[model samples]
Target: MKHALILVALLGLSVTAVAQTVREPDGYRMDQYRGPVPDSLTGGRVLDPEAAHDLWQAGEAAFIDVLPRAPKPKNLPEGTIWRDKPRHSIPGAIWLPNVGYGAIAEVTADYFRRGLEQATDGNMDHPVVIFCLAECWMSWNAAKRALEYGYSEVYWMPDGTDGWTFFDYPTEVITPEPEP
Candidate 1:
């Protein structure tokens, strides 16, 4: 009976592993046009805001937000006050907007590579935490790229800004400088 139980356990483990295998649309990380997000990313462990916050507070991790900036409204009335929206992210998190979308334009690709290098100071072993809004793929792609770039430690915050705000964690606004 013990041997039979062990065999059954092994079968269950195999089934679970097969079930988690990456699939078509989810597996494909390079879609420029907006589409459905994958349930999982290729690399990095999924992290929550609380844990990320702990890491940030401990100064053991670098945080990055990959959300794209919203375009300014066009065709506004002549007297419209064009106040820029408040750009907030996890405290101490750098906002690198154009790095994650798959199949991006060449210019964007260059920007991403440069942004990443700048973020880590070219140190691939930096413990980096990446995030975006919930249900967004940009973070996933960016995390995968960081791993591909040979970062020893990469964490993906799947809950994103929503999760951070949900915990009533304070956020800070960070304006990204124009690329040189």
Candidate 2:
């Protein structure tokens, strides 16, 4: 009986350790951009697909897709053709690729700020929905950054286009806003 109790205690400790390791970080996620995400954001609402859909139908929110663009290889042979990957996102969403990384360059930061200003028409109170792919940390980082930028109404749709399309919601191909 003592041995059985010790085994149960060890299992409990293992579960607790795993849970701790998976908790959300205090700051941006520095790496592993794709993985499970927390269910909440400190200064923004964490939205599910249904909630995002409702917001979309309301026409009062601006959806921003932050899926990163894959840059062309610099090592490709001269004359080798390279094509950019196509991305499909929720209709009417503004694609601001590469602006969601945990750490961003000054130019990228300017682009993100400018994109937000354009999306909200310079209204900080306008509702902004930020996303990328499902289980992507880029959205989380971007949402937090939006909050820091004094956006009063920010929503983080962690499931992003994956969740959006799962319900047969329509999507459209979008080009990223040019970086400054």
Candidate 3:
């Protein structure tokens, strides 16, 4: 038991160090999110792909994809066929668009809070992982929001889904339902 506890503590420290050292990729804009992000969220930690994969395989976390759903392009001369690009994410990640990606509106915030409650069955201690595209701020905002909502184990996957797939991690296609 002591050894396990020690190992966990060391991992926590390592994650913190990694988070602090992470630099935003070139061309990342702060104006993108237009929301405050603290240096750290008390119980939330930043995770690399390996750490995220471990949690995923172990079923120890709820993975959330905060990437916004692409809007259908406007303007068609007549009948130009439009097809969506393939939608894929780390296996089992829930697609929760609009949960983050700028200052969250009140309605969307309420919806996200409720959805999160249902997702975790109201268990605040359930581990939750939030992610989006590499260098995207959406995942950062969502992860911080989860922490603010009292989730004890929030993980921000800064490397995003593409990073996971880049490493040859298995991915699953997810078809999001149309919102009413």
Candidate 4:
């Protein structure tokens, strides 16, 4: 009986680990875009990074950062500084790290909601693009939440912040409060 139970448990664990779901660290899944993304902000639609960048350059849209703060640098060595400020913000992207941990705190659901509120400014007609470092998930979760929140134009840069920098685009760096 013990062996049978152990075998069953192992099977379940394997299944869970092998799940095809693009489960984000913050619980965001890519499969969320299978349906309609309402015209919440723009009445037309949200734009991706490229288009959003064009709009930003043209003064039509805004880009946002959604990296959560960490208590200890998840990807950095000991004694690394938290990149919390809102500068080098792609000329227009706002910094809103989601569920900051390790060095970041206070990334609650409400935190996300508030950020969205600020992004749209009580209007669902605004276009916003959320991103962070590449091969990451916080930004993915953020973008999906925006879509679920009914924002019309939310772009999840599959490539992440690296994509932006990789393209040799513009960027800004700033100091953040790290809302503990």
CA RMSD of all predictions: 6.2, 3.9, 9.6, 10.3
lDDT of 3 by residue, 85-147 (tens): 777898777777877754667877777777677667789898888888776777877887788
Evaluated at residue 72, the lDDT of candidate 4 is 51
| Comparison by lDDT, 2 against 4, better one | 2
Give the TM-score of each candidate.
0.74, 0.87, 0.73, 0.58
**Considering TM-score, where higher is better, how would the candidates rank from best to worst?**
2, 1, 3, 4
Q: Tell me the spans in candidate 3 whose CA falls farther than 4 Å from its real position.
A: 1-30, 33-42, 74-78, 177-180
Candidate with top TM-score is: 2
lDDT of 1 by residue, 12-79 (tens): 76644544454435443666524344555556777878998788789888788888776669999999
lDDT, each prediction: 0.75, 0.90, 0.74, 0.56
Which 10-residue window of candidate 4 scores lowest in summed lDDT? 35-44
Scored against the true structure, residue 101 in model 2 reaches a CA lDDT of 93
lDDT of 2 at 73: 84
User: What's the lDDT for candidate 4?
Assistant: 0.56
**Model 4 per-residue lDDT tens digits across residues 39-117:** 2222224344576567667776556676654445467877767653444547556677544222223356566667667
Backbone clashes for every candidate come to 0, 0, 0, 30
RMSD in Å for model 3? 9.6
